[model samples]
Structure formats: C-alpha cells, structure tokens
Target: MEFSIKDIIEAGEGYHIEFKEFLDKSFVEEVCAFANSGGGRVILGVADNGTIKGTHTDNSFRSRVQDSLRQLQLYLDIEIRVQDNLIIVEVPEGSDKPYACSRGFFIRNGANSQKLTRNEIIDFFQKEGRIRFEELRNEKAVFDNDFDERAFENFLNMAGVSRSIDRMSLLRNLDCINDEGKLTNAGVLFFAKDIDFLMNHAIVVCVLYKGTEKVHILDKKDFKENIVENIDNAILFVKRHTNVQYKIEGVQREEIPDIPDVALREAIINAVCHRDYFDRSSNVLIEVFDDRVQISNPGGLPSGLRPSEFGRKSVTRNPLIASLLHRINYIEKVGTGISRIIQAVDENKKSSVEFEYNSGFSVIFRKLDRTSEADLGESSEKTKGKNAEIILEAIRDNPTVTREELCQITGLSIQGVEWNLRKLKAEGKIKRIGPAKGGHWEVIDYSC
Candidate 1:
C-alpha cells in the first residue's frame, strides 16, 4: 500500500498505527505486537511528535531490517515499503496468535507494545481458543472421589437417557473423562459433590441491594452446587425478590414475574456456560438493585466474534460444557441465547435488556417503572368491584372451591383473592362450610 508522509503524520499513533523516528532492535517488538493484536502499520522515519525525520534507505538497509524480524520464532511476512525518505512496515494480524520475540510475549495495548506476564500469556492462549479449559483434565478430580451419583442420575433422567449404559461408559461417551480415567474440568464442574470445594470460582453469587448503588445489602446468597443447580437457585433467588402479578385468562390464573423468567433464565445459563473457568478469582455475579438486575460472568465474548455479530454468531469457549448442557436441554441452541433473552423481555413488555462486553460479559435487565406498577395497581382496584361479581359467580358454579382455587379462577393473587372474599362475606354474599382445609365456598344471598 502507498502512503503520503503528511497523511500518516496527521493519523498519529493509535491501536493500529505507530510512529518511529528510526528502525531499532525494538522495531522487532513493535512488529510482533501488531501481529499479536489487530494488524497495524509501523512508520519508520517518523518522530514520536509526527515529525518525519526520515531513515537512511538502501538495499542493504532493507535487508538488515528484514533480518531483525526473522529473529522471531514464527516467520511473519511484513510488507516493507519505502515512500520518499520514510520506511513503512505493514504487519498483518497473526493467524497463529500470541506472537513473541526474544524479549518476551508482547501485545498491542492502545498505542504501545506491552510485554505479557506469565499468567497473562496463559490467559491469552485460552482466550484465543488455543487451549480449552473444559478439555483440561483436573489432576485432583477422581470420578469415584467426588462424583455425585444422584446428580448424574438426575441429569440422565432430564436428558432422557437410560441407565442401561454404565456410569463410566456414559461419562466417556460424553467426553467428561480422558483416556487416563481422570475427570476433565467440565466433569468436575457438572457432577462434583461440592463444586465450591473443588473449584471455588465456579459458584454463583447473588446479591439484592436496597437501592441502585451497592451500599446496603438486603439479601445475598452464594450457590455452590453443580452448574445446573446453581443456575436454578440463582433464578429462584431473583424470583423471590422481584415482583409478581396475577394474569387472569378465563378461569385460569397465571403468575407473571416482573422481570420475564425466560430472559433471566437464559442470561444465567449463558453466564455459566460461557464464563472463563480459567479465572479462579471471580465467580459469576447476579446483582439485583431497585432499578435493574445485572448478571455478569468472568469472560467477555469469544475472541473472533465482532460486535456486529454478537447475538447472531455462535462461538463456544467450552464446547464440552456447552454440549453437556445441550444434551440435558438446558440450552436449546448454540447461539440463540441472546436473541431469546431479548425476545422474552420484549414479549413481557418489560424494560429492554442491556448487554455489556468488557473484561467480562454482563446482561442488565431493567425493572418496570414504579409509576407503571402504581397505575396497574390502581387499574386492578377499579376493576375489583367487577372482579367481585366474577368471584361470586365462580363460587356459585363450584361450591367446593377453596381460596387457592378462587385465586386460580379469578386471576388474582392469594392476598387479592382473600381480600375480595372477605369483602363478599362482610356484605353477606358468601359463606364457608366446614374446616378451612376441606372447606368449600358458598353463595349466601346470590346478589351482586
């Protein structure tokens, strides 16, 4: 590619561009960094302040520069072009990533080349999918030592698999065990008797705060069970804390959670399935505030996925874990979780869900407006007089109906149904027969 030196100066140094007054030994590090990250062009003969000092160019000088890049372990084809007095080196993004130099492993951070620490290098490999966390065998994990037979049996039942296949055979078929007979990390997470003991960061932490900020905690629960159990329990915690309303359709009443249950469930499942298992410091966090509920996991989106293809693309960081979950019907499809979450929220007419991707991935479900809840409550009360007539008619139709049954028949909460019943009895419209347990509702005067 051709470049005008004036245009390069105006562009300055950034994530995909760098400026160097002259080529030095450090130019090799710059080349490696660009290849490791998004590919960028390093312009020699350009000063740090965008001053084009220009470098001495000859056939021998170009050969010497090429020789320096060859010192890298992996051979990279760098596009070297001499424009006027400036030398431009265009390095394409490495297909085989985590490129290194004799100095150390380096990556482009903003405009600079930063050498990675030992742990950072390992994390980079995992993020690039070069190393899968689920496939790695846990040295301390033994099938007989910590495997929960009951949990495994429950999973088989849910998955509709027969117990005719022995446990070891089933495990092997599922890729939960390696040839050495040691359980893989995926197996330990899914069937371990105590995941908290086996892997501390595999649990789910739920917190309910009094307000938006994390100042005062009203309730908190750390679920340290198998992956499925943790997901279920985390959802249960949210349901207990969030609001619920009764929706009456004819004679049947449905309890609708304030935040759509399907959306919340999908978020939780996505978090557990795609979270970074390599990061042992942080667990999946579910935080509920007065305004919103945020669910976050350690890892962001998979490496190759672009922002535009976020919900549309299907990339599994832990294929083994995802496959196991899919077998048990926890996940319906590979890449539909995000879309399903959005659809659930929209169908419920709840506030839109927000997705954030940084060092970690987060889904925030906004709560319904307080004013809207008040309006709904007001509307329900206004229709209560008519609802009372419906209740009376229902009691006449079924004299053996219980209060709980009235709740179902009338499309009201237990408390709402009870209040209506009490008002009817006070008006001499209905009565109860026998004990509360076996009692039936009776119409007294049969007047609305």
Candidate 2:
C-alpha cells in the first residue's frame, strides 16, 4: 500500500506502526514482535521523532533484509517496498503464532518490541491454543497402575456413562488415553493416584488472614487432589473462614454466605479450569480477608480476547479439562461462568465482584458489611456465635445428624459445620458419643 510521508508522520507510531532511522538488528526484533502480535508497518528510513531520514533503497539492501528475516526459526513472509526514498517493511500477523528469532520471543506492546519472559512465552502459547498442556502425555502416568478407579467411576456415573464399556475404550473415547495406551495430562490431573506428586502445581492454596493484611494467618490449607476435588476443597476452605447469616423465608430458614456460594464456586472453577498448567511457580490461590475474598490463577484471559468480551465470549485454554468438567456437569456452559458470578452477586444484593488481570487473573468478592447493626467496638465473636447457635439447634433436632445433613438443615457448609463442631466440642458444650458412621451428639450445655 502506498502512503504519503506527510500522512505517515501525522499518524505517529502506535501498536501497528514503528519508526526506525536505519536498518539494524533491532528491526528483526520489531518484525518478530509485529508478527507475533497484530500486523504492523516498520518505516526503516524514519526517525523516532517522526523525521524522515531516508535509507539505502538499493536492490542489494532489500535482498539482505529479506535474508535476515528468513534466518528466523519460523520463516515469515513480509512485504518490502521503497517509497519516496524510504524503506517500508510490512510485517503481517503470523499465521503460526508465537514467532521468535535468534534473539527470543517478542510481542508488540504499544510502540515498542517487548521480549517475552519464559513464563510469559508459555502463557502466550496457552492463550493462543498453541500448546495444550492437557493433551500432552505424561510418561509416568500408567493407565491401570496409577489411575484412581473410584474417581474415574464417579466421573463416569456423573457423566451418565455405563461401566459396561471396557475401561481402556472408555478412557480413549474420553480422549484421556493416547494410542500407546498411556494416560494424557488430563487423565493424570483427573484420576491419578497421586496428583500432587505428578503435577504439584495443580493444587489450590487457601489462606484466611486475621484482618485485611497478611500480617496474621488465621488458617491455611493446601489441597492437592484431582482438579474437581481441589475446587470443592477450595470452596470449603472459603466457607470455613467466612460468615453466614440466617433469614426466615416463609416456612423455611435460608442461610446466606458472606460471599454468595454461586459466585464463589464459579470463581473457583474458573481459576482451576483456565489456569496455566505450565506455570509451576504458583498454584491457584484462594485468599479470604475480613472484607474481601480473592481467587487468583496463573494466566489471565486468553490472548486476542478483549476485556469487553470477558463474560460474552467462550475460549478454552484447556479444552480437555474443560470438556471433562462439562461432562461431569461441573460446568453448565462455556463462557457463562463470569456472567453467572455477576448474576449471583447481583441477586444477593452484594458489592460488585472486581476482576483484575495482567500476567495473572484475580476475582475479588467484597464481603458485605454487617457491622452496622452492632456497636462500633463490638467483638466479632458475638456475630459468629449467632451463626453457631443455628448449628446447635440443628444438632439438638437430630443427635445422629452428619456434617452434610447439618449443612442442609442449617444452610451451613461442610467446613462451616466442622469448624463450629470443633469450637463446640472445645468449649465442652457438645460431645460426639460414637464414631463417625453412627455418631450421636450429646449437648452438655445449650447456652452460648
């Protein structure tokens, strides 16, 4: 395309335009960056100040520039032309993305060519769907020896598939096994005997701070299990640290968590499903403070996905993992998790959830302020005891009630009920008369 020098100068340098005074090694980096990201034009005869300083337009120089680009690992086809004594090189967006030269992987950021870090390159590969970690085979993963049969069976039942099918056939059909009968990464993540040993970074780290800062850690847990189990365990951890309020809805008493269950669940699932498995530096994190809860994952939104498309578009970084979750009904729909979280928060009349992203993605849910009803200096123990009372009543109603049963009866979660039970037993208010299976509860003192 022909462009007037006046017009090119008027446009200035941007994401799709770079100005260079002469041909240099940096031009290759610029070309690679443009090819990796969106296509852009490099005016070799132009100065950084937008002053036109013409370069050699000889056929030999043109041939030299073309040869230099060809030296890259991936051959990129660029358009070169001489316009009004200036060398204009047009680098198109690469079809085979993540283009790199001898220098390193480069991507255009604003008007500059920024080299990608090791983690950044892996993240870029994941976002572009170039490298699917879930599809890669784990050499140590054996189909029968290292598989968790019970977990696989549970998944099959949830997916509504019959056990009559041969185990190998079923696994192959699910794309969890390769032609060599070896398990894929997804298989290892979902049904491995020891997920932590094989994929340590797949775990979820949960922390409860005393207040807003990290000065005091009230509780901490590292859940290393199958991806599905990790999600559930993480949610349970959040429930243990947060508050619950009871409401009378006609004949039923409704229990409401400080952060809506739907929103928290969605955030947790999103974190697990979309996280960059290649990034072993950090696992999915669930941090609970006095005023907010944050769920963060290694990689942010996929490349090419605009912030405007946050909840509207569907793009799977780990298709195999997402597909398996979908089969088990863990995920209802693709690209709807964010919207569901927002809807749940709105329905609960809670503060809006904030999404912060860069190298990592974080979903922060603000806790509702319930302190207005009480005095300014009132201890939080009073509010906690109020919720604990509901658990006490549930235990009184059914001495043989299980933790799950109590959760259903009082709207308290499994971890919440467990925490309350521990506190009750420690205070000598309630005692377990027998083992877990046929345990009966005895109330020593009903007063809170």
Candidate 3:
C-alpha cells in the first residue's frame, strides 16, 4: 500500500516506525511491540534515505510474521500489507490486558521503546479502565464564545453551586470561553438554547424506534434547546417510557419497580454530556428496543478513548458542555457516572451496561428480568440491599405506614421517604391503598 507523507506529517505525534533489512525474529518482536502500543506502522525494505529497496517478497517472510504473532500470549487484529517494494505491517494495539513477547511487556515512550516492569505493566492495564471523559479539549472553540448567562446559571443549579458565580470566571475556568470572547464548541453547546439553529452540529436527537429498522418511526423528538434542557428533556423522555416498581414495608413486604429512574437519568446525562457534537447529521439517539435500550451519539470514541477506557478516563467531544454539566451536578466531577451506573445496575440485580464505539458511540442498557445470586457474585457474601432492605424491613414492621411512618421506620426524613417512595412507585414495586386517612401501603411484588 502507498503511504501518504502528508498524512503522516498531519498525524503528528504517537505514530512511530522501525525499518528492517528483512523479516527476522527482532522484526517480529517489533510487530508485537507496535501491537501493544497505540498502534503504528512498520516499514521494511526501505533505506533511511526514504528510498524503497524492497524486501524478501517470498511467502516465508509473511509466514514468519504470522507465526511470531501466534506465539505471543495476546492476540489482536493486525493488518499486514506491501507497497512500493516495502513490507508494511500494521499492528493494532491489543486491549486484552498485558501482552508480552520474549522481552516481557513493552510500551511506546515518546517515539522510543521501553520495557515494562511488573508494576508498570499492571499500571498500564489498570489505566486502560481508569480513563476519564472530561479532559478532552475543543481546539476549534479555543477562540470562540464560551459562555451564556442562562446556561451558566442552570449549570450552577444542576451542579449544586449555591453561591453566585461569575460567568466569565466560570468560562475561563472551564477553558471554553477565551479572553477574546470567542466561544468554544463547548460554549455553543452548553448555553445556546437553540444550538442546532446556531451550530447545527450541536443538536441531540432522541428517537424511540418500533424495531431496529430506521424506516418506521414509532416516536422521535429533536432537542434543539440549550444543552441543559436537552439533557433534562432527554432524561424525562426516557423516564416517560421507563417504569419502576414499589416495595411496601410491613407484615408482608414486597419489591416492585419496572425500572430505575436514576438509571435512566444517568443514561440520559451521559448521552448528552459525552455525545460527539461534531457530527452534523447525527444527533444523540435513544432507541428503546423491546429487549434492550440503546443510547447512541454520533462520532466514534474520543482520541484517547478505548473500549476498556469506557468509564475511567475523562475525555469529551464537547468539553464545554461537559464542564457546564459537571458544575450543574448533571454528572460527577471526575466522570464517575459509569461506575455509579454499574453500581446501580448491580443493586437492581438486573440489567447490563453495554458500550460500543463502532460507527458511533453507544451505551446499551439491557432490561434484565431476574435477580440472580450470580449478579452479585463478585461480592456475593455482602449484604445486597442496604437501600432495599432498610425500606422493606420498615414496611414489614408496619403496613399502615405514612410518610412519617416510613421516616421513623427507615430513619430517614419525610422528604427522604417521599423521594424513595416516588422511586419505588416508579419501579412498580408498591402502590398506595386509599385516601391519606384510610390508606394503606400495598406491596406489589411479593416475590422479592
């Protein structure tokens, strides 16, 4: 294959190479090295003068490379080709944990190769999952407008900022609104009520498809509103379709809730905060399938994001929007929604969070039916329901419970009990019997 010098130049840092006389054991070692790192090209049969001299074009040369790969512990998708008498083997970095050849584990260090110690190797694998999604920069917005007064105020409210905050100061802190009054893509996304009208590319679309087919539209809503409203509206849209149960406490306790509102809210916030606003045609899509729900946004993973890095690193396609959302408490500061969602899903003892970066970014929340012991197998012995058990125990103690009764039983405030009741009812776990005077708590699912 022909290589573009201009593309190589534009690709800038992180791309590396090693030219060889012919296919050899060391050459195979280099192939594994490139595969372990963030991937780069290896050219052969070319002189240092940038002139192609060609390589041993026999099938053996290719066989040796393939054999070396098989011998290595980790296997990944590697691309091998030849162009202009040069043997170019493309190694895609493997994500199946630590990979090693005869030299043990290795990593690319600023255009040089370095051997990884046991600790270093462990750290590398850990970091693959510890990536955050908020640290990405919007270079295009470095010199653009980055603040909207209403967006800033709304963000502060969502983030739980009680005190008054300066709009310019907040923008400067987020690095979206520069001193020149130019807005970053983030500023446009967060503040502009009609971002789609202004940026066109910043719109978020939430669609509820009848099936996988795109031709039939069961229900769809486009969010051209400001980023904050877009996030809230999208979440409400999901909640509109989502259901949950209520678990009544008393002599015969029960668990109910078709779905968790918090889970839906988190999914919506994540979709809005991390979406690739750079893609013009595509918007953030929330497709509710019969068995599973898929939340997708245009644009593949961020530059430094990998599948394993799903919930770890802070990367953002629209950094400004993320920053504002962060301040407003829509998402956690360090990008902890993924872990929180995992925790919540585990608590429900159902559902699995599936992440994909193909074509566009997608997070699929599957609807699970069972509460298996294996769901908490990681820590099976631990008490499963602090929240669920506490509430259930209180209701078991008293069936004619009021908000005050719930508070006294669960040691929570009336407001807290009300919140939990709302959540429980949303989950389909419980139902109120009658009027406040003669009303009783009705447990929905006695199975739990």
Candidate 1 local lDDT, 231-347, one digit each (tens): 899999988988888889999999877688889899999999999888888999999876678999998876556678799866566656776787678888777899999999988
Query: 55 in model 3: Cα distance from truth in Å?
Result: 63
Predicted candidate 2 versus true structure: per-residue lDDT over 1-448, tens digit per residue:
2345555454456556789897788889899888876577888888997788888889899888887788555887789988878888889888887688888878764345667654665565665554357767987776778899888888877877655556776676565777677888988988888887888888899999765557779888999888888889998899888878889988999998878998988899999999988788999999997667999999987764667877876655675677678767888877789889999998987456999988999999876545442322223787667767877887888898777666565554444556678888999999999798877999889998
Residue range 1-448, candidate 3, lDDT tens digits: 1335323322222224555666666665666666655456667775543445688757887777677667666777777786655677777767664667875766543333455554655655464332222222444443324335677676656654434334554444444444455564556666654465566655667777543335456778887777778777887777666545556677776644334556667777777766655456767787765345788877676554557867875444443355455545565554567777777777776577777787687778876644333332212323324545567556656767666555445554333455566666777777787887887777775433
- lDDT of candidate 1 vs native? 0.77
Candidate 2 clashes between residue pairs 3 or more apart in a chain or in different chains: none
* lDDT of candidate 2 at residue 41, scale 0 to 100: 86
> How far is each candidate from the true structure, as Cα RMSD in Å?
18.0, 17.1, 18.3
Candidate rank order under TM-score: 2, 1, 3
| Candidate 2 TM-score, true structure as reference | 0.57
How many clashes (backbone atoms < 3 Å, residues ≥3 apart in a chain or on different chains) does model 2 have?
Answer: 0
Residue 40, model 2: lDDT of 75
Q: Which residue ranges in model 1 land beyond 4 Å of their true spot?
A: 1-126, 370-448
